[model samples]
Target: MNIVYSSSDSYAPIAGVSIMSLLHNNTDADEINIYMIDNNISDENKKRFENMVDKFGRNIVFIPRPDLNKMSGVDIEVGRWNISTFFRLFLCTILPDNLDRCIYLDCDTVVRHSLREFWETDLEDKIVAAVDDCRSDRYKTELNLPCDSTYTNNGVLLIDLKSWREMNVEKDFLDFIIAHNGNITYVDQGVLNGVLAKKNLVKVIHTKYDAMTVFFDFNFKDLMKVRRPEHHLSEEEYIEAVTDPYIIHYTSCFLSGTRPWNENNNHPFVGDYLKYKSMSPWKDFPQYPDVRKKSKKMMTSVCNAMPKRMMIAGISLVHSKLYPMVRSLKGKRRG
Candidate 1:
């Protein structure tokens, strides 16, 4: 089976972690062809990836290209690189016509189960298949059409290359985006929703495949209300329910700064994230505990160096006065 993943230097850890899990868990496919498209990755990271390839003894297709530096100047308002332009670029330049189908997984996701089932599932002549983002109804509406529209997350997409190319789907998406001038919020994903909605080419898959964790208040109890056994857990319960999840998408939560490696950050799937991270070839790159300690020391030093650090510009005063309250707020936020 062919799988496509895009990697940039900044998010190398996520890509490394994702690749490691796929190689470790997936045994159903005869050949796992990893089409790694690297953009602005460091030489060290590339060497690390090469070491993984050597260890696996499996075929990996490396497609090297110039950096996306040109697009860097373009304002990325909605999704990554704006939805319209990114897809057009990928389909027109990055992908090949020889391969008729492939599974595209976002770097921030972890695949726990074998993807053979997903890869083999019939698309029914559709260009793509994905799961709905159940976190926010408003985001889905802006992306999918009507407010209650079931907007599938583009993080995990099953693409039929033949259909996509034949229908000029990418061009059509770009045309729409050009017409709208990239005003949409969610970029390529938003356009994918709009395009597929118009053609009725998207099939919604099971929720278990792309289980997403949104904000702390993502209504896990509502999940229990669904009669479907697959979707039966409450949000809080779901966080701890590690029954070999197919995919765990750490999407927007990582945006504001709490990473899996941060000691202060308590992720619901920290254990799982660490488990997958450990499997990666680059796992040894950063020692999380050491890094966290170093970061804390630096922050403390910088704060202490300030002239009024402990005086009136008072974070120290706040700490003294509201330390317990701050701790309480943090504790409440933990999943």
Candidate 2:
């Protein structure tokens, strides 16, 4: 499977760690290549990442983009123009050409199961596969879009690169940003939804494929059964669930005050995060301190400024606590 990710210096270590988790746990893939692009990375950090991939038995394609430092844009929440504008260049041009189709994952996710299901499933000629954000229904109506599964999270994409290029998607998407002068919520994601909606070029993949921490309100266990139907797991079913996820998107990094990696956060996946961290080669890298600091700052800013729904927060907290108990009970039942 071809995997793609874009991160700046602040995220390469974690992205490298995430890639390692994918390689170690996902056995179904014949080969996995991580396409990582970072312009701001220190040579030391870059070398550390390379060494980590080397030790972990995965192929790494590292692209260094020195020219990206000049771009700038407002982060809106921080009241300062941050440097995420460079991602536009990545979305438009810098990607590699070896793969006709690719799975684009944010650096924050850890794959618990083979992504073969996502990569192998036909897109039915659609350019991408994504899930609608739970909160974006209101935004969709405001934008005059039909209230279907239209507001998608771009964090996990099953991209049909050929279709993306054939449809001139990148150019048209960039033009939309240019026309709007880069003022939009959620950056590239919002513009992507604006451009792709009703175009018959996007397919709504199973939400289980990208089970975001932000939207845990729905009956996901049921949804999982329905989509990958006939595969039902009772509350006592422990191994079955862990062994079969398509992707475990740790989108909590996108939320403020809510990450397992943070010192004072109650993230559901804290144990799992630590598990991956313990196996990471960054344990020996000298830049660990710097990486942790930047990761904390990024997650803090995102969570603090994001709009909160009390119900969602409550459910998330409950799920975090309940899941382990449920898993324990499932194990007993299975035994």
Candidate 3:
């Protein structure tokens, strides 16, 4: 199994925990070739990675950053996102031509199960297979996509490199980046969904594959009320995802600076993340003090105090009203 991750020096520790979790859970694989797309990783961090993988009897290969001359003039809205986020867009140029398939995981994820099934999932002519994003239809309209089109989260992509190359996905992605430029909100993620949404080329996988923070934070009814068709997960599936998730993506909490590695993050999966961290080389790394704003902390506390059913009801009502206003605004913009 080939698994890829991209991170810079600052995010290396978090990436190390994610890698540890993957290696620990997927030991059944005959071979696990881990690849890291480097954006100037520090020598010390590299050693840490080497030690972590060495303990598990797996080797990690670091792919140096590729030239981004083509994207020089393209405007990128890199709000809070590392420039390394764009590395996946150029995997075809960075990885060996002979490499035909690979799984890409974000540094903020932890795997709880063997990836043998996910690694061998049939792409069936699709360039990528990924779980749908929780942002729902809002993201489609935000990217000027058709309302019914699927918009996926790029955090956990099963890529078919052969198909990506044959279909010129790299060039198409570059073209989209150049065309949209400053209008992009989620950087490479926006470009990916915008360009791929209309192509019928993305396979929407089950939510258990990438159970995000939102999945645990929100109830099933709340998710259904806001998410699009492609993002739907049955009640049974939702329960299974929370109880026995294949991959737990600390996306929202990571983005919001409330991750398990930080003090007072309070995310439900903090223990899961810490369990892997304690087993990694960076186990003794100091946790950053929780510096969240008082207002945000208060809000989180209030939300946590509410009953799950009440919270879902409140979010559903908001979505019911907000979706119409969003549609109206979009219609006027089109006009």
Candidate 4:
């Protein structure tokens, strides 16, 4: 199985924890080859990745990072995300030509089960398959996607390299970036949804594969209330996804403003993360503190204290309506 990851120097250790989890859980797979897009990873971190993977009898390759500025000549707004986030857009150009497909995982993900079934999924004519994002249709409208489009999270992707190269989808991604003047709030996620979500080229897979934090923290009804998604996983599927997740995606919580690695976080999957972290080279790494400001933490408390419906209405108004408007206006001004 070929898997891809991208990380900056500071995040390399976190990515290593995820990689170690994957290597441990999928010992049954015949071959597991990793390719990481490096953004100046320290030699020590590189050696850690090498030694850890070697311990599991897996092969890994490191690819040099590219200049986003040089490629686009447009100022890209990466928000709080590392610039390495855009590396996925250039996978067809960066990965080996002979490789037709590979699984792309975000550094925040911890693999808990064998990925052989997910890896063998038939893409048919689709260029990519991923779990749908738990959000409102308003986000699709924000992205200028069709109402019928199912917007999937880009965190865990089964990418078809042959199809991407053949269709020159990178051009589509670049055009979206250039057109938006790189002022996307959601960064590469915006590009993926804007470019591919409407074309019926992105298949929405089972949510279990990329079970994010929201599913665990909120039930199906509250999720609908908060996210106001036009469509989403059913209650049965949602329950199963979170309770028996195959891969735990430690995305930040709206209420906590933190992930499992943070000392103050209350992530349900923290135990799972700790299990793999203990076996990683960075086992001695310190747990991160909750870095959200006092004001932000206060707001989080306020939001949690408010009636669920009120919190839902307010966040939807800001997230789906106001926040996207700001992104669009910023893009237009930049353009």
The candidate maximizing TM-score is 4
What lDDT does candidate 2 reach at residue 22? Answer: 78
lDDT of 4 at 22: 96
- Determine which window of 10 residues in candidate 3 has minimal summed lDDT: 224-233
How many collisions between residues are there in candidate 3? Answer: 0
Candidate 4: Cα lDDT at 205: 93
Q: Write the per-residue lDDT of candidate 1 for residues 1-335, one digit (tens) a residue.
A: 88887777767777878887787778666888887776667888887776775577656665665333343333334533422225333553566768888888877777788989999989886778887654333343334355434467788888888888888776676665654554544566767887775567888787666766543313354232211122233454455433446877766432123556555545566677788778776666664443434555665556546564232235423432344345335434531
Instruction: Give candidate 4 regions above 4 Å deviation.
Output: 328-335
lDDT, each prediction: 0.61, 0.59, 0.79, 0.87
Better of 2 and 3 by lDDT: 3
- Each prediction's TM-score versus the true structure: 0.71, 0.70, 0.87, 0.96
TM-score pick, better of 1 and 3: 3
Off by over 4 Å in 1: 64-89, 135-149, 215-219, 222-243, 254-257, 287-335
Minimum summed lDDT over a 10-residue window in model 4 is located at 326-335
Clashes of 1: 6
Residue-by-residue lDDT tens digits, candidate 3, 1-335: 88899998978989998999999999899998889999999999999999889988998999898756445465555766877888887788888898899999999999999999999998786788998776656657766788777778889999988878888888888877766553455677887887777787888888888988877765677567534344455788889888888998987542234667788777777888899999998899988677767876776666667786675566555554465356547545644
How displaced is residue 327 in candidate 4, in Å? Answer: 3.4
State the lDDT at 128 in candidate 2. Answer: 81
TM-score of 4: 0.96
